[model samples]
Target: MKHLFLFLLTLVAFPFSYAQQAPFQDEINQFKQQDEQHFPPKNAILFVGSSSFRMWNDVQSYFPGYTIINRGFGGSTLPDVIRYAPDIIFPYHPKQIVIYCGDNDLASSDTVTAKTVFERFKTLFTMIRQKQPNVSVVFVAIKPSPSREQLMPKMKQANILIQQFLKTKPHTAFADVFTPMLNDAGKPRKELFREDMLHMKPAGYAIWQKALQPYLLK
Candidate 1:
């Protein structure tokens, strides 16, 4: 009877602890393993985020002269990015960082509110600035995927905060991909999305490449 009671107690406690700590531990472990190979203290442009970073098939080919490192993992969010920043981005000692995240968090319903997403972003930026004082941080506004189109108003709110925040700093730049990618109706251009309409097609990536080039070149 005593053993059964203890086991039941553990079961009740486990859920709360796992909810708080396990995901963070898993992200940290993933960061330690992945960053060593991709970053390695090289003079490179670090593309850090979730799937969008991972899906860039030919970043180097797009920008030939610079060393481009893709540090994107699928299904990650701002908290994961903060946990992995030292591994993936700072180790590379990047000249600039191109970041795209929060989309997955919104799409997965992992976050509670737009303000929660913005708070996470603010935390991420603060952490990066403190650790990498000289490196340029270029934030990519969350894209409008068909699956996540209903959430654009929230995204726009987040972007507005980003725009205002960047105005006060010189090293921080905001890459405004949202405006160009939108059609006259304020919807994402159909040509820019893949068949599922969640991910970007090559045509969409080309748009990013073009916008990113001038910022990096400078």
Candidate 2:
């Protein structure tokens, strides 16, 4: 009876613990501490989002002349980004903000739809605009990935919705990386992905660099 009771407690405790967990909280805190020691330049381009942006460690190298700061944390969703925006995004005073989330939100849960994802993004956009009215906002279109092929349909839809939304907002741009990342057969190109077929290779970042270059504030 004691063993069974313990097992029941474990099951009950697991859900609450997991629910309370804030993904990448430590990583975000580290960025703040680093900033206190030596602040990142003001009026630079700030990149914030999911693992895609987090893994793009050398983003500054792509745009040699521009001052850029990347605040991406792996496995973050739109809501997570919004939740931490005040601490992560506001302090930097970036002239432009580039984002790349939502893929995780879609993959992590089956219930989340493309429309819902877009709505969350709008919420984030609204918050940013309220604080930084003239800031240039760039949304990198979700790229098709071989590992997450099953989720691509929804991903594509989210990208389209976001891109269209950007069209209506002045000083906002969408980097349509979806088209260039696809093969003629309309599938995610395998070469662009790593062995995991998820994250990216240098070749993949190369494509992003090209797609986003024109949109970067001069």
Candidate 3:
């Protein structure tokens, strides 16, 4: 009877322990592996965020002169970025950081509001500032996506909050990729997105490249 009770307790704890594993651990590990093989140069401009930055695999080509280190992982939210900042942000010792996130935070749950995302981003910004006080930070606004149109109002609010916050900080800029991605009719440009309507096609990225160019640190 004692042995059976111990076995049952172990079974109950196993799933809970497994579920507690950090999200995106595999992706973060993969980045570590890549760094070991051929580490990126320090003081380069670092692009860190969600799928948008991750999917921009050839981002270096878009900006001819700048050396960019992209550390965007797919399906990531603000908290996830914060959780892995030691691995992704600080290690690179980037002179500048370009962030494109918060969209997934709003989409992740119905209970997650615009204010929630804004607060979360502020926390991330504060973390970066504390670690690298003078690094130039450019925030690429949460974009308008056709598939997630329902969350546009929240996205817009969060972008405004983050932009306002950055305005008060030195060496910070807000790139308004959100506005240019919209059509004259105030709708997302479907042509800019891939078939899934979440990720961008090259056309969409072209818009980003143009918006972000002026903000990049030489």
TM-score of each: 0.81, 0.90, 0.93
| Alpha carbon lDDT of each predicted model | 0.79, 0.92, 0.94
Q: Each model's number of backbone clashes?
A: 0, 0, 0
lDDT of 2 by residue, 50-141 (tens): 98889999988998999989999978999999989988999888999999998888988899999989999999999999999999999998
Spell out the clash pairs found in candidate 1.
none
Ranked by lDDT, top first: 3, 2, 1
- Mind giving the per-residue lDDT tens digits that candidate 3 earns over 22-123? 999889999999999999998999999999999999999999999999999979999999999999999999999999889899999999998999999989
Clashing pairs for model 3 are: none
Clashes of 2: 0
Ranking of models by TM-score: 3, 2, 1
Q: Indicate the TM-score of model 3.
A: 0.93
RMSD of each: 3.9, 4.0, 2.4
Error of 2 at 22 (Å): 2.2
- Model 2 pairs in collision: none
